[model samples]
Every structure is written in structure tokens, then in C-alpha cells.
Target: MALTQEEIRKIITPLLLSGAKMLDRHCPRCGSPMFELNGRVFCPVCEYREKQKKTETGDVEKILKEKLNELASSLPEEIDELEKHLRVMEKIIELLERYKKLEGVK
Candidate 1:
């Protein structure tokens, strides 16, 4: 039921190549013909727009990493809270177990 990596690649490569050719024939941004530059896709006018968009939002991965670092720094405090909550839960479970034993029910 599962495809091997090689088999998946074999099936996907033609589709990818075809899609690239189609994209070269038709631009994704404006539905105009795409001009290839050094094997990279570019629509001259859209390129400036894309750059502006990037400037507006910056790199996604870098932003994600900065957020992740902020969260990671807070994790020790969160873990301490979680451990306290877990201890409370364990106490509740022990009381339930003792109640069941007193009731002579399994």
C-alpha cells in the first residue's frame, strides 16, 4: 500500500517536470509567460512585487525560529506548573483507588 521513495520519485518527477514546463509557459503570479533566468522562475514585474511582499513579512523560517526560541525560554516555568498539576491529578487517582478498595469493587 505504501510506495518506496524511489517509486514515488519516479512517479513524481515527470509530473514535476511537466508542471515546471507549464509554469514556464504560464506565469503563476499573473498568468503570463514566465521567463527563466539561471534556471529560476521570474516574472519581471511580479518579481518586484514579490520582493516587496518579502520585505513586508520578512523570512518565514527566521520569524518562526525567533518565536520558537521565545517559547523554549518559557518552557521551564510551564513544565513546573504542569508537574504541580500532575501531582494533584495523582493524588486524585490515589483517592479514587482507595475509595474503590473500600467499596470492594474492581
Candidate 2:
């Protein structure tokens, strides 16, 4: 069903009141303007959720790398504590690699 302009406005009003941003990009399905709210990008008219931009992933990857470096430099002397630290470092490396792969695609 096609929503009237009034219906669209009704849907968007609360978001705007709560500080959701109206984005410049339009929806592929309905061509209605998209919005960004609480880090989520979506089209209110079509109710379609958009994937977050790759730049956001890049930022996450950088933070994980920095944390991994910090953990490495502060390694614990105890074997059990060292093992726990190594496990966390491994997870961070895994996340960094995953983000790198995602950035390669569209």
C-alpha cells in the first residue's frame, strides 16, 4: 500500500522530535529520503534498513588495533594471565581481519 504524504510525515515526526537526522540519500525502492537514528540508517517510507558505511568499519578496526597494541605492551608475567591476554588479542586480530574483508566489498 502506498502511504500518503501525511502518513509519511506522521511517521517521521517523532524521529525528528527525538533528534534523528534526515539524510541526503534516498531510498532505492521508494525514493523517499533516508534518515540516520542512533547509528542506524533507514528509509521510513519503505521501512528498509541500509548497511552502515565502510568508513564506520574502518574506524572500528583502527580502535581494535590500538587496543591490541596496548595489551601487547602490558603483557602479564603470570602464565594464566598471559594466556587470557593472548586470547583477547587473538579476538581483536580476528575482528580487524573481518573488518578489512568487509571494506574490500561494496
Candidate 3:
């Protein structure tokens, strides 16, 4: 859905206040102006949600990898406990791989 001018203002005001820079580029989907925040450029009306989803997905991937690394470093000497830890790490690895594949689809 295309955003009305007032809707765009509602979204852009806080971004501008927070130091988001208005860009010369326009959104291909909506023809609205784009802004850059923390090096990510997007349209408040069009691409903002897409950008946010990508950023959130990236965060989740990072967190899963970190957890897997932590589990790897904490492996137990006891065979039973080691198996449990390996199972958890395997799940995390699977999640990370799934996310990587989803990103490729995008």
C-alpha cells in the first residue's frame, strides 16, 4: 500500500530527529523519499519494513551463532553431558543454516 503524505511525515519526523539523513534516492515501490540511518538506506513508506525485517533476521542469526560457539567451548568431559551439549549446538546450527537459506531466497 502506498503511504499518504501525512503518514510519511509521521514516520519520518522521529527519524529526522534521531539524525537520519534524507537521501537523494527514492523508493522504487512507492516513489517516496528515502533516508539513511546507521548506514542503512530505506524508504519510510516503502522499504522501511523490509529493511527492519532483514536487520532483525541478521540479529537472530548472530545470536544463534554466538550461542553455538558458547556451547562448543563449554563441552563436558562426561560422555552423557557432552552428548546433550552437542544436541543443543546441533539445533542452533540448524537454525543458523535455515536462516542462511532464507536470506538467499530474498
Taking the tens digit of each residue's C-alpha lDDT, what string does model 3 give over 59-101?
A: 9998998898889889999999999999999899889989999
- Predictions ranked by TM-score, top down? 3, 2, 1
- Tell me each candidate's TM-score: 0.28, 0.53, 0.63
- Summarize candidate 1's per-residue lDDT along 1-106 as a digit string, tens digits: 2334653365435445665432437545555445454577665445545555555444443554465455445544567886765565566556555554644541
Clashing residue pairs in candidate 1 are none
Q: In model 2, which regions exceed 4 Å deviation?
A: 1-52
Top candidate, metric lDDT: 3
Stretches of candidate 1 exceeding 4 Å from the true structure? 1-43, 55-58, 77-106
Clashes of 2: 0
- How well is each residue in 1-106 modelled by candidate 2, as lDDT tens digits? 4557675767778778989999999878777778999999988766522233455676798889899999999999999999999999999998888887876775
lDDT comparison, 2 vs 3, better candidate: 3
True-vs-predicted CA distance for residue 10, candidate 3, Å: 6.4
Question: Candidate 1's error at 53, in angstroms?
Answer: 3.4
Error of 2 at 3 (Å): 15
Provide the global lDDT of candidate 1 against the true structure.
0.51
| TM accuracy, model 3 | 0.63
